[model samples]
Target: MKIKDFPHAGETPPFGAGGSGVGLYIHIPFCKQACHYCDFHFSTSLKKKNELVDALCQEMILRKDEIPGPLQTIYFGGGTPSLLEAEELAQIFKTIDSHFEVNPDAEITLEANPDDLTEAKLKMLAASRINRLSIGVQSFFEEDLKLMNRAHNAIEAVTCLELAKNYFDNISIDLIYGMPDMSDARWQENLDKTLALDIPHISSYALTVEPNTALQKFIEKGVVKPVDDAVAQGHFEILIERMQQAGFENYEFSNFGKPGYYSQNNTAYWTGKSYLGIGPSAHSYDGETRSWNVNSNPKYIKAIQSGELPIERETLSVTDKYNEYVMTGLRTIWGISLIKIEESFGLKFKEYALQQAQKHIEEHLLFLDQDRIVVTQKGKFLSDGLASDLFLINLS
Candidate 1:
């Protein structure tokens, strides 16, 4: 289907009005070990962990006023935040409290690796204001864990869940599908075991062969089979059908949550809400333009210590804004709303979007529920391609 040809006549809007309230993403780039498929900026060494934490706290303190609202959502993502000592994390939180305006009921989340989870640590995290724990339990199968070089085994993954559940009521588990050797039956078994836990949220993602990763190298050498698109599609279908049948709403392409359990932090991003990202390799978006820190941890530390921002930024164009909304919205239950397209971009773009979306609707690849143009079940996997097709040209 052809998308409407809309012109950005003028450039897109800048990020914020004196930095209106923004979500915070604090990246922790240290880990016990690096997974074969992981390309995210992280290191396995603990030598500089404490120093990095101090730097991060300082970074937050320096950038506090840049965010206008008391922090609504604080997400600790990356190099295995669960690896930090609970007290260390608490120190960082205290620093944030000192400089920033954090709401009393802020939805604080920590990304945890299964092997790093412990009963004591869970207690410490709970005692702090961290209300949610998103565990990295990539797969429930022992073979899958070994293939991915995960530090935690199947038993450890399962045990971590049980332990985490005892302390944190708001728990989300991350699972992977369509791995090189992950069979359809095994995938189903993983789903069954996950459903048994009855987690409040589930983030399931299909394995992709990203560049420069060990998985990509393995495929090049024939050490591991290349990813099977057919197999991935099959598993995704199972994921959607099973999760929906289990009463889990497909909130995002890779996320499922029970009623009232959607991830507010992530939702903010999808809905064009402003957010601040701190630490090495983190990216921050403020409704319009986006900025990111240097990927090198040592470099980030050096820059911050010199009293500099330690980042590079890009201004958003009208095309960039429109395309971002299309890309993110199509991946969620909200889809793309004509009203939002109009309000955010302008009325001219809105009229063009609705006119263009009619083609996809007729092709049965998209659903038109009044003002909302949503992707159909068959179109979910092709969401990226479809969104790209509808993008406004000349982003630069």
Candidate 2:
């Protein structure tokens, strides 16, 4: 079949035609060690790295027909995509180039760790097609680094950013806030250091202890103090104020970016654009259905090598789509469109949404802007809960 003649042709508007375009997410499931708060799919052992890389390339070939046209964004996310050798990245990129037509201005990003980004490595990446870098510099303090067990030290975080700035222009760094012992002053210092570095984009989040993770176990055993939501909320408020003062847009709940520096890959996802995800535990969506590959590395490699895809699929219900739209839209700067809800899902759903949102609006947590419902600055942190209250449980 011709690449442009895919099954869902014309189902959605093409990005080049002024709408959001398709994206590709390649998951690399290898890390030197696991972080205490992380629950994402990954393994510490690099024994199967070669086999996994081969599987990733093969999976791309198998799913190349799934994309409608040229890719607008390509993201290498994971346990540490920076761990891949230059040659490995080349081989993968060669396969992508051969099978797909990438846009000349495509936003190709690679998620890296601070320790892996040496001067040599930065130079190597600058020479490649990766135009953006998302470095995992979770914290800038030595105690926080030790508590989280991050591979890089505080100095490495600063040094890598200094070196990386000389090579790449579009750079983003991750920061975590609201740890047990984190004071308001400490959080402010973190923001201060980020601004001093002149980073273009920042993705920060409150530290949450996930079930079965080391953090959870520690909290349970009293070895580590339990996380306090009040502290997290305070940190979040500080973050918003600081970033605003620094001329950064709180584009999404957890992301802040300078003008023209927003993450295209992430924006597409929040706006409900389709994307093709490759590699083990990666997810793929094509407007209607959502599918994910097997999370087990050995199983994934074996399946791909045998010319089979180890995936599971689910077709979203109308209510499911509406709920998702409300959830994502509320968290973003682009407010939920009452017109879109009614036009796409029917007048009943739109009316239901407004009726549900009325209470919050009266409380000064929400407001109507012409034909859309937007969260107030006071409501931004509670977007998820507010969105849930507007969900239609019986519409499906």
Candidate 3:
């Protein structure tokens, strides 16, 4: 079962023939402590970390025939990949290298927590194949950190970046805005501090209360103030203005990067490229089909041990694919190509898109930038909502 021998090898037309490349997303779902706002699938215990890692590697071997070509990017996300020991990483890499053809200069990324990235750990990562770091440095203030229940302190946040920059040239930090009671001055300080470190990329998001999370519970109990939408929009505006001023390109909504520093892994996902996601609760896409593993660690491990995949699959309809294209394309600078939409989804779908987008264009929320439909600055903050408005609700 050769990967290249598979028909429709990769998702996009250009993928197998030097177009959009394949990616691997490895979810490590163990965290030292859960953040208040996080609702991602994870556990606070490391009891199954070793077993889970083994299952992940096994799943890769079992699904070796799925991907099309050599991987251009490999992302180690969730449960703090930095928590894994160097030996564990080596074993995982050995399995991957033996099974797949990884590009020599592939963009291998590992999501790290500031507290976990000690000097020793950084040195190990520097020597390893992981070439990029996405550090979780939500805030540089004690009050903000305490509110979010983040494990790393403000000092560790600053120190980690200082040390990380010395080891890795490509570094991205996560920053949260719109926290309860966060002020403009405080938000400015966070940006100022981040800029001071000269980080190459930034992924910023507004703090939102997710159902069943500690933050949601606190908000429900009035223990924490609710997130204000207007305040969040204001913060986002400030972020865009500042980041653009700093010469960073807002390549995608919530993501800003310097030229040549955009995240290859996420970019592939946005551009409809195929990726294989390993581990519990992770998702994989092979163009037409979307599959996800069970979210429970025990179940995921048991199924793999029993030689079962433990994954549920869904084959997307034509309408579903078109909606996804609109949603992702509108949020990106590349925008949606009208000709591609017409050719791929048929002339009627393209006409419907143009008709639905006409109102927003009149409202100054969207406009035709040559052959592509793009969000104007006035519509940037509300791009998701605007994109949704243009979706094909009834494709029958």
What TM-score goes with each of the models? 0.92, 0.95, 0.95
- Each model's backbone clash number: 2, 0, 1
- On residues 263-349, what C-alpha lDDT tens digit does candidate 1 reach at each position? 878777776788889999999887667899999989998888888888889999887889899988887766888877888788877
- The 10-residue segment of model 2 with minimum total lDDT is 1-10
**What C-alpha lDDT do the candidate models reach, one value each?**
0.82, 0.89, 0.88
- Any idea what lDDT model 1 has? 0.82
Higher TM-score: candidate 1 or 3? 3
Candidate 2 per-residue C-alpha lDDT over 121-218 given as tens digits, one digit per residue, 9 for 90 to 100? 99999999999999999889999998898999999999999999999999999999999899999999999999999999999999999889999999
Q: Write the per-residue lDDT of candidate 3 for residues 1-396, one digit (tens) a residue.
A: 232222222223232113346999999999999999999999999998899989999999999889898899899999789999988999899999989989876889999999999899999999999999999999999999999999999999999999998899999999999988999989999999999999999999999888899999999999998899999999999999899899887867888988778888768877788899999999999989999999999999999999999999999998998999999888876678788888888888888899999999888787675567777767889999998988986675
Which 10 consecutive positions of candidate 1 have the poorest summed lDDT? 5-14
